[model samples]
Target: MSAKKRERPPVPEILPAPVVDSHTHLDACGAETAADVAVLLDRAESAGVTRVVTVADDIESAKWVVDASTWDSRVFAAVAVHPTRTKDFDDAQRSGVERLARAERVVAVGETGLDYYWDYSPPDAQQDAFRWHIDLAKRVGKPLMIHDRDAHEDVLRILEEEGAPDDVVFHCFSGDAEMARRCVDAGYVLSFAGTVTFKNASTLRESARFVPRGQFLVETDAPFLTPHPFRGAPNEPYCTAYTVRNLADLREEPVEMIANAVRETAERVFRLPTVTRG
Candidate 1:
């Protein structure tokens, strides 16, 4: 017998206001060309996910993301060599990422930081690459998008040591309430992904509740982390609609309010152009 295939969740109703998926992987989400990107974005727009910041995880993706951003007005890009891939981040890789980071549509330098869960890259190498990315963000005047997994303490210490960029966002933030508070105090924005909607993610839920407006954002990290009820299903930018609704319920705020707050925060943090809905 064959294993069952998970069904993709039906797109939730359009949000009351537009929101942004602060981080995602268009390439990983099965988009290979401009038309494929459009199909996904079209679904997202219907659900009121007006814009997205597609992030890169390696040198090839860094280049692809920059090109994808140019293919559509609603798409923006973030380029970085993810922590696990930094084991052999040579000069060519560094220069490639740096060059792409300067692209007009590349709004942030990130999906970078330490990942202790995977032993793919040694801690020392990850830390070194992280520091370099921090400086790159500062030099390019862009927000630093982080990918902190289980190495919260080290990630924080390194940021303090390197003098974090003007804007820093912990993408798919996995810390507890105290860590959230620390990041908030330091003016670092926490971006919640579908994990916050999991039944067992009480700590993440608590952090979501604790983060004040303007200090937090939402993302799909899609092609992964599909919101609950659709947990194992394939995820895309459109699924962000489900997460946004769940967040409103979690925070006990109106849906439209949560939508507007994250949208505004993303625009300011990424310096993205204001998206006016027709």
Candidate 2:
């Protein structure tokens, strides 16, 4: 029998306004094929994702992330061991992470913080690894990208004790108003993701409502938390528009206004040269 030709899916449409996905993990999703990067970037660029910060959950992923960012000018990198993988941060791994952090494509350190919900790693080890990443970011003079999953108190405490850099961000923020206020008070940027669009996200929405215009950012965290209608499907960077729209609705503002805010905050946090980093 002759092989059947695979159908080409229609190109995903772009949002009318520009945006910047401040956080994502392009290299991790199992479904994302090698060809998807360009196609995904094309769709994202069309949908106004001028830039994206692809976070690495561990030392090895950081290298792939760097390679992806290097291959595509639109993508930048954040490197570190996630809380779940804190056990992986042995001496050799720690040194390698530090070296990767110093890479030109690495703009921040993390996807690292506390994840008490999973507790895949010991709490003490997570804390130690979190502190190490923060210190590495400080030493390298780069920003810090935090991932706090149901461990807000511990995350905040560590950041305070470590004296988090001026450019700290809670990527995929899922905290309450108080946490939002604390982050704002500490001058940390909050990057919202697809989860913000979930119906049960009142607290997250409340936090988003309070985030200052400039201190707020948006992202896809794609190939994972597919937003709303796309939920249950494997997410891609192109679907970020749904997140942008959801954010605008929650903010009771025009999509364009939120788009501009997202772009601005993403540039500030990621220090991308294209947007208003000033």
Candidate 1: global Cα-lDDT? 0.94
> What RMSD does each model have against the real structure?
1.3, 4.3
Q: How many backbone clashes does candidate 1 have?
A: 0
List model 1 lDDT by residue over 98-131, tens digit each.
9999999999999899999999999999999999
| lDDT (Cα, tens digit) per residue for candidate 2, span 1-278 | 12221222233556666777778888755424446667667767776676778889877788888778877787788889888998657999998889888889788988888888886798999999999888898899989888889899989988889898879989889899998999999999988888888988888888988788999888778767878765666666766788888888888998878878878777767677755322
CA lDDT, every prediction?
Answer: 0.94, 0.80
Q: Ten-residue segment with the worst summed lDDT in candidate 2?
A: 1-10
Roughly what TM-score does model 2 have, to 2 decimal places? 0.91
